[model samples]
Target: MRGFSLLDSSGLPVAKTCFDPANIPEALHLDVWRQASRCGAQVDSLQRDWRFRGRTSNWYTDGVVFSHTLCDATHYQRTPRHIRRGDSDCLVLKLQLAGHQQGIFGDFDHFSSPPGTLVLQDWAIPYNITTTPYEVMAVSIPRYLLRGSHLMYRRNPVITWQPDSPQARLLVPILTQTLKSLATASAGEADAYAAGITGLLDGLLLGDRELLQSKYRERDRLEDMRQYLSRHLSDPDLGADHLCRQFHCSRATVYRLFQREGGIATFILRQRLQRCMQEISRMGVVQKGFLEALAHTWGFSSRANLARHFKAYYGITPQQAVEAARSHQNEGQREMNAPYWRDAHRVSRWLESIAPGASPTEPAGAHGGTRQGPRELAGH
Candidate 1:
């Protein structure tokens, strides 16, 4: 479906469109990226067999937040270089409606949630998400709304609520229903609905309030350190000693707070590399001298140093990234006005081959050693 929209009886705009990659003209199969970007998200890469069907609805309360339900795709989603450069901050609360997902949250901490599980992901941090034909409802909440709510604490990037739990049982249905109502909710009604959802989240997450309350002081100090780091990411001199002196804390305390992000020095380097990556992507395939200057601007010792570290972290050289970006840009421009179902025939064949009992050749490592079956779509 395309160009589909919905509005309330009062004429309030609701959903902008309802689309399914499978039936859409041009068959671009970029629905995953399209829907994600609509909700202020970016994808590092999508599954080769990537196909998506989803709807997005908008709501306004204290601020505008959107709800999205995506189904039938597996991909890695993250804060892209451009989005991160703009300092985008939000929290995505995901309710797994079906299938399974496994990924890393924050710098460490791996998570695998099955169907019916609820998880909270911080948009400020990059994540590597891998899912198999899953349907998930993602509610985008502004970071400021969640600040100081125990949800913002650095140590809790990914919080999971089991579906069978009492809190999940009570809150999940309510949250899902609220999202559904957003499609045609009046402004006043939307505000009340938003408030209700917020209250439920606060109650669910803070139910074990004492545990977070006990570490309030520690969380405060960590936030302070994190703010300081953010302000001075380009400062090569920023290190453990600098933090200790600035925050008036012991070296041990500084280490403990950042231990999950690797030590203080490692964290700083990672931040610098991240900044460099953003710059490189923005610059595209540019002159070597310009690229080197860009690296120096981000506080790297030299372009060589940037190249080595960037490859290690991103698994791609700076030049390669530039080339890829340029190539993607050129291809996008060429297809700018092409039909949406340009490759419909190819997609149709692939889909057919993966139907029940079909022995389609599976892409190596696509399932990470899991057995292939009809349910598992083959990646090109």
Candidate 2:
């Protein structure tokens, strides 16, 4: 983990890091890479064929991550446990410059990514991917940053944009040029670059009518399931089995369809907790007995159970939620609303040795920030 910082002409803090020789010997790459990568993916170096090597460089700023890498045959997996922990707080867009990769994605077809194609990976869903030697430019944007983009990536059929598409033709060159320019981009310029790049991604991905229709078509089914969940949250038997029986859907279909929210179980727990909190907030000066009863009504086995999840999700317990509600303290909760990015503090911690007194769960973008120019990179 090597890092250095500088202040551009505008006095903005610029910091960049590169794990150039991520692992001392190529053979030790897999064993030592996690120390450098806080993203929580399991990367296994392949045996035989060729020696394994890679480098990763990241420019940290603007609630976004810009990465450039060069790596050979590697297998990557993010399990359901990783998604439950919310380790991946950003949706990654990989702009393939060379080589290709194949993977399984809940939201898209199991297809190989071709040179010059842009592939988006929603960290909320699990993945199993392998790539050949390749040079690529990738970006990680926090979920909050794209709230207004109207990107239902989980339902979008246009998972990978080919080099021949009009959108790819216009966007690929722009990103390629942007990455090349980042070696010296000023803090102010980096801000503009992030904005411009995300804007184009939002518009281009949404521009195709056929793709947009596919997204809405699936969204209809998901929406119907959501409504069903909302209506039956208090039912003790409400879960994947109930969903399957009611919707005539399979267990695999239930889990696959809800991967957008992490998974079926995760979605159910989060929703129940949220509704429980709403009820608690209004129960001013409640007694222990009432809170205990309220917890069960909201699906928790006990008040203690509710408190555990409440603390994890809201950064406060049920009692505190009541006090804050009475005092009208809504600001902090709003800041914590971006659930996906909530646990991404690992990125910031890896980049700059953790901001002073930053909470372990605080997002990198939530704290005081720094900007950086891209540095030499290989891969991880």
Candidate 3:
């Protein structure tokens, strides 16, 4: 494993690194820092209206990789201008959690990856960024580690990926959720997070590498069953018995597999309605005629059926949900073209008393400074 270091409470690199910075070419440092700065500024602009200000950052490695953050007006221009790229390369995966950004990675390759979009790029390359109103979670890993993996090296070098398929979908949600959890993580959790990341990366590349062979085989069978049902949602005959015969599985086993998602018949109906609703949402609420026809066409069986299920799941009737979704859609579009939107600054003051050094009895306020409320100091 590559040598590593971490941050203490003071947020400083606490280990003696092995990588020699003096050997790095001077030109590369300036270029990397320039892009880092622009990326930092773009994120800061997005978080300007929030109650929170500034971010905590740490940079350390045995010269294998570097990581840092520039929050609280800590712009990227302050980074050193020279770096050695021989022993290792750097890849930065930026997750924009709040705002949107337009960036150009290579001369002709432009990206408009919005909030929830993950951007991957090489740090050795020159990149430019366009700012918007939002913050980001950025991860910088050594290129050598990633490139050494047979999986990553084999894939298209400049591909942008999304978690869409059943097998691949877990990657997106898990990664995003982990990143968010990391923001407030304690020192003890850092190593665990790092291990989880590496394992996940390997699984992503090698296709669920951590699972037992039996589990992997089961997943494949389940995935096939799912796809078959999805493709034939309208068939009333699409029940457990059909699945048992098609997959050569026992009726009990088939029923058990789908039990978690409701029985096989209920699951099929749910999927059909969900698909129909997705199409309706895309067409807009005003397309009332098309919407009704689509429900029946998608195997809802009747308008009442659609309405009942839609309300049960979405808390709104089909017509009302469509209207509400349209309103939400229009609002989102309006915000996109604008420079910024107002963020709600309604942070609860009760957070102060519970801050870092606060006593258990204290009513605490959080999100930076100024503790308020009855204070009973702990660990004093």
Candidate 4:
């Protein structure tokens, strides 16, 4: 029996692995169990007609982001005893491309998913999933990425998106296209797309006014704080007091929102350093006093301070990064002149078009340094 093969955008098989119960008579159930366990969950009980077919394509993103396509015959999967040990603490955003499924999610909530419907299932919870001959495309995202979003705090076992709502109407197609596009997307492109997906989910969660009004004020406050920070990243005076004044929130709330990244001050410092690095990388070889000016622009106290922090964060001084950028400038220009680069440039422009407030111009010096680095494309 030929096994499943993961294909690239060019339709070439990047990975292939076969699992057939027929091939191994000694362990008829081993093949299916292997598939289930290796992925995330466990197949608690397999029906007599149980058959499994699955393929996974992982995209290069900030965390464990991947698309798993499966066509399974009849099966029941659960998170039991030792099964729970493998919990990934991730969320599976399953899009029913074909067929249907019904399951008890989050212990109490039951859901039926049909074609075009989107369902979000948290891997941290105990649940049972039952499906017939069904085909599904599921994107697995790390839960922490959605930590501050209201959806992450929802008690619902599974959040399902029907085609009826305005949000679903807009979200479903974007997700479907994103899943389809990942096959061809470069690592840098995939990172950008993954961020787009996260932004969409955040919007979906925040758009639910009823849910937000229930008891999610803290989540809203966090979201607001994040937006304020983004806009004020270059503000040297930005701090807990500024956040408190702008958002009318306490200093504790400001600290809590940024706790995962460090404290509020640390988060701000990191952001400034990141911006400085980007600016330095883009300018390549800078003119006299350029470093000092860039540092001030990004809110660094001084060029020396920026250089120290930049070296610590990126393992190279800002001057080294500028020199590297200059060295690769010609090569980047030649690559940008290529057909593929033109295509990529057009795609980047299109992305910026769709994302309001996104800069249409490619970041300066992006052409030279590690062309497809995730961190490089992350700013795009």
What TM-score fits each model? 0.51, 0.53, 0.38, 0.46
Candidates' lDDT values, in order?
0.54, 0.58, 0.41, 0.53
Off by over 4 Å in 2: 1-13, 48-55, 148-150, 215-380
Top-TM-score structure, candidate number: 2
Off by over 4 Å in 3: 1-214, 245-250, 329-380
Error of 1 at 65 (Å): 2.5
- So what's the TM-score on candidate 4? 0.46
RMSD of each: 15.0, 15.9, 19.2, 20.9
* Candidate 1, 1-380: lDDT as tens digits: 01112222453433223444554432344532443353243433223334565542323333325455464433354655533343334556778887777665554434667888988765556665645567777665444343233343345667677988776788788878987886666545665665566556656555655654554456677767876776787665678888888989899999888875567777777666656655654564487587688677777777898889876655557676666445433222234333333232222222222111111122122223221112221111
**Where does the lowest 10-residue lDDT sum fall in candidate 2?**
351-360
For candidate 4, list the clashing residue pairs, or say none.
Answer: none
Please give the TM-score that candidate 3 achieves against the real structure: 0.38
Residue 70 C-alpha lDDT in model 4 = 55
- Report the lDDT tens digits of candidate 4 across residue range 290-380: 9888888888788898888866654557676566445433221132343333333332232122111111122222223211222223223
Ranking by TM-score: 2, 1, 4, 3
lDDT of 4: 0.53
lDDT of 2: 0.58
Clashing pairs in 2: 14-371, 15-371, 54-379, 55-378, 55-379, 56-379
**Model 2: residue 259 alpha-carbon error in angstroms:** 22
Indicate the residue-level lDDT of 208 in model 2.
Answer: 58
